[model samples]
Target: MAFPGERSQPRGTILIANPSADLYGSDRMALEAARGLVSLGWRVVVTCSVDGPLVPQLRAAGAEVVILDVPVVRKSMLSARGMLSLGRDVLTQLPRMRRLIKDEQPDVVLANTVTLPFWTLAARSCREAVVVYVHEAEAALSGLARTLLTAPLRLANGVIFNSETSRRVSGWPGLERRDRARVVPNGVGGPPETLAARERLDDMFHIVYVGRLSPRKGVDLVVRAAALLRDAGIEPHVELVGSVFPGYEWYEAELRELVDELGLAGHVRFAGFREVVWEEFAAADVAVVPSRLDESFGNVVIEALLSERPVVVADHTGLAEAASGFAAAVLVPPDDAEALALGLSRVHEEWTDYRRAARSDAPRARRLYGPESFHARLSQALAEQAFPVPSPSMKDASWSPREVLD
Candidate 1:
């Protein structure tokens, strides 16, 4: 792959495989890493089982993209029919993937998420360096899922975790003992040059939530929380700025019904999938992340902080870890609409203070999770895996303020 800028001699070929092509957190990071590697003079080829919005971006970044008809294990595929379909997919994809691995002859095989552990097996047979970037925390996995995901890491050359919470919850003590695991927190694009003043929205306190509208994401709780605020005689404008997942359109309908049932129709707006979501974050008084699942890292939280907007996240899972240091952030109990409401109420009452604190602490998040830091760490991790070198700086800190800030 080559970009428009001056290119260098190829370092080595790399094959990056992801489960889905949607532009979600994991997929987004995968593209970022692929683009970074390309810029570093690596010939990159990206493969995924499905296709979506990220295909054009991958090509624009000068990475060759190939859509493969492989079977990926999903959480929704736990039923009888789904299991049968999965079995068929695995049987067909096994030999096909093995052949592709042999043909590519890549120096490194990068697996983006845990759902596609088959890449590890294929890379092992080809004697190529294998790196798995785990984006989900252990608390979110079932017993069988956890076994399937970690059993292959024992053979992996390197393991990259998105957050410290993901690293600890992964229960992979052997990776640490072998000096194979590294925590590379997710990074985001820099915020706009200028942001709208938060004080300008004094008349209507706008609350924004960004991500998929699924049960696990807890969008319903946001609706309930908005209703609770309405009952408390405060009518805050809540703007939801994301669409539902592939099979979860009903969840969006359900949330709308919930809003109507609670008489919050006028107070809530579902703004589906905006290209410039950061603008929404910059305009809001506060951002909310009420995930019921154990998130590995909340990228939206960082985006909000970079936009200088205070955040309120659920206490459970990696959400609490994502909002640890910011004085502007408030932690509320997971799956509790009342708790979320109270947290929002607090932000509403002390809006300016939280906004000021958010601005003061925003640079810390950017300095740590910026693109330079992410690409630098990623290059080092891959280089060490390809050729084991000894260096004192490889030692990870016992605690990093950035690790807790997602």
Candidate 2:
């Protein structure tokens, strides 16, 4: 298992273990972390269970990507039979993970999410430093499930949470006393130039929702909100710009049926999955994130703000934190279609104010969530766990913000 860039005198090596290869929120954050490590002159190798769109992006950023049969813990695998399967996977995959770590001789093993608990355990058994980057905040989990999910954190040398809400909800013992635990928000990339809101040539107000179409994401609420607007004589066109998980196809079907039931079949459009959503935001009068569950953080809200589009988001947990202090964003109660519709109506009535606020706040959003800030903070966090801080002379000459953002 020879990896590329086998250097005799590299500064250090880091192997990042991630659960998925899809280019979703956490997947994009993992890619950014790899780019950050590469910029710091570390030999970056990323391992995933399967390959998808994120593999090439990692390689292009100077990180090596390896596909392996990594054991991942999912919520559906918490049942009796599922627990047996998980135990079997741990028994079989642990040795391979240990061997890989021994072969790579990495300075640190970074488990990207709690789902890859086996990676942390393997690294510890090898006497290697390990860090867990947590991207989930499952408040709905049972007591037994939550304990099992966070048990791996005790073995980690350091832990990074995406938000304060996430860290608080985790409730892991000694986390408050731990010096290495930190909250680093997701770095979201946006269009090169912030485009102004497009003028409407017709009576239709375009709305866009850009994330997974699962029930937790509350896509059905978005559809129902559009129906409410129509019933009140406001013509709104809703575009859902993402798809569902592997087994959640039925949820998407239900959404479509709900649209037809509310007589919004002509108003709602399923735009499907998209890698780039700036064009969708450009065409939308407003963006909505109506998640029913607690999101660790809201990357899409930041994306909408960066795109200079007014946003309506469910105000709870990380979603509230993401939209906080952004005047262009309107917050409504979670899972309330009427409240969401009212928020959307408020933005429509005061369209001029919201538009100006969005344009005015675009630069601030860039300053806070841009790639440069994200890479700097993430690299520093990982570097601290791997080794001492590098001096100015040790910085990589080829490292640039443009390279990572691209």
Candidate 3:
């Protein structure tokens, strides 16, 4: 019952809970946010799967990161094992969370992502109002996750959604979550200075996609698009970055077969999940985001633009709005292979104009979407919810760009 301004606890702490760590955009962003929070001198704690790509980075960032053995999203959607996994998630983590409550007594419980916010509900019951960060605009929530968020979202002192689209998708309409739902776009670290500049620009028309090979991500669209290009006497080199998640092996295999059937064996390469993925983006002429659904704020597109690379995105979700802002990117119909292929060719044909636009937009993004702004906005939101205050510069832009980095 520790609602905002109803308690007198001076010392404050926050626990960030997540159910995954597959080195995807969301996971990467969570790591950045955690590290930024620590630098701000806030005692932070993060709990996720025991074997995540982020553990070492978390430890280095000066956070008390605890890797808990929990069941993540299983491949077999509805199975006895999945039910048992959910039970273990609730039972196993609940006690560990109870113990942390007694020891640290955090002032706020901030669930980093939506998929695993039961931890927030549990922690809020013991502590203050929970602050849940909704990263995905519309995640396929299980019955339990749906029940968990609906009422408690109202119960929590605050909710921070990545975009207005996300808050609405979660069913908090008319800004019911808006009073507390502050939109603090993610901040990305500046691309490494050593990122490989595109040297084979004239030699090859390479199209790169940097995300997991999941069905919703629309990697198949890229596969099909590659075939379309080949048919039209164009062979664009396509590179895929990021590893397969649990239960997504079948999808990965299907993608592999599609690559073979399309005769794109040499043209399309599966660069199996590298830790540092920017180098691949750097080496390509264009970055492609062929997502069919669930891209609340596609961070990869911005990263592509950061390197002065043009992007071809599905003309839906928040990405289209994102791509339009700087005029540094191109918007094509979602999952349209022919359109995607045509877009790729245009980037090759008119490289000068696109690169010219990206050069102007990249610096503006550095100030607006970089780490400094993220920390500043997040700090203010946490403080405002913890205390009380008002809000930002541009009130709102109708479907404009919103970030989701760290």
Candidate 4:
């Protein structure tokens, strides 16, 4: 079936540019969008900086994957030397981006993250409509840095914020002026069948945490919380189901040290990264997403809820939004281990009730975050941003950065 606004004939092509090929939160969302678009009769092309698991997944979803060295904004690039390097990259890559837009002649260019400012510039220079799918929200950045980072978003014909918090935190004044922005929560796919939370024969409570093992993600707090539970005479087995970024290996080491210091050697385990986490959620009595930093949206929260597992997440930003109104979710202050422990303790104390609530809420979570609901909302959002496709005669028109600058 064609999407609401899709024509009977194949809809025009869409080129999606993403920064990484890792199947992380944003990567998974991008893949979902590609799959939905392709199913709706749109030819999809996905571009990434490197090859990883997401490459094959995108291709499997019927997207043409292109490995390109796109200029992506990173925290390290704020330094003087890094800025110079970034400048050089932009100077060199911007032309290629413009050329790619010209060659693909897509109806819309969807830049998956706010990091790729040059993608918006290139698409505009090519006189093509561009939409930015914003998935990051760092409220801690200095005013100047935030402005500099988000300035390019003004050039986008449309902006798709992952959550209401993201749309608000973006601080772009023009977002509501021309109906240029829409908030579409990330669509998360759950297991084919809801795996009922297993009853533990032993007193040990299984707690699962998924996503990056970074400081900002507050993985250490989970360890501390585990220690707190132990101090309270509760046996909790905490499983961290993700790995850290290349430069952040030290964080994982520190987490291990903290686990040892807290004497949680047997209680806490780092399972590294997993492509599929349904089994982990299935076995988990409870899940925790204690992100200390701002998140645009929490896909893991929805995943846990859909898995019929009670979840404890930080009560701020998009995490709270994702967990809001869910009967099985427990929200605690960001970065507070004691509170996390307390929350988990409450779940343990009332395990039967919580488990029942989790099972009852699974259907609701599925209705809101399941693949069908997500695809429908996404289709409507994209259809709203549908700009008139350029005529075939105008497809060969030459455009350059100099013209855009002038």
lDDT, model 4: 0.85
lDDT of 4 by residue, 1-406 (tens): 2332334547667899999999898999999999988887778999998889999999999999889998789976755576567878799888888888888877778999888888998898888778999998878887767776777888988899988888888847767988788888888898877778866526788999999999999999999999999999899999899999889999999999998998999999889899899988987899999999999899999999889999999999999999999999999989899999999999998888898999888888888887777777776666555533334774567543223222
Worst 10 residues of 1 by lDDT: 397-406
Question: Per-residue lDDT for 1-406 in model 1, tens only?
Answer: 1221223456667789988887878988988888888888788889988888888889888899988877776767745576667777687787888888788877678888777777887788767788988887867667766765566677788898888988887747678888889988887765666484457444767899999889989999999998888788777899999898768888998998998898888899999987568778876888999998889988888888888888999987667777888888899999999999999999888877887888886898888778778877786677556544323574453532112212
lDDT by residue for model 2 over 1-406, one digit each (tens)?
A: 1112232235478899999998887898999888876876779999998899899999999998888888789998866677678988789889989999888978788899899989998998888888899998988888778877888898888898988888887756697687768888888888876679965425898999999989999999999899889988789999999989999999999988898898888899999999788999988989999999989999999999999999999999999988889999999999999999999999988888898899887888888888888877776676667663334774554442212212
Q: Give the TM-score of each candidate.
A: 0.89, 0.91, 0.84, 0.92
Question: How much does candidate 1 score in TM-score?
Answer: 0.89
Candidate 2 vs 3: which has more lDDT: 2
> How much is 232 displaced in model 1, in angstroms?
1.7
lDDT per residue as tens, model 3, 1-406: 1223333333257677766766677678778877877777667787776667787777788778777654444324334556466666677667776676556656567777655556665766675546777776655656554444454466566778766556656745644625777777777775776243453455557788888889888999988887887787666788988667767899999999999988889898888888777678777778899888756776777788887788888888667655658776888888678888888777767777887777777777677678888876776677555434212443342221111100
Which segments of model 4 are wrong by more than 4 Å? 1-6, 79-85, 199-201, 388-406
For model 2, name the residue pairs that clash: none
State the C-alpha lDDT per candidate: 0.80, 0.85, 0.70, 0.85
The residue pairs found clashing in candidate 3 are none
TM-score, prediction 2: 0.91
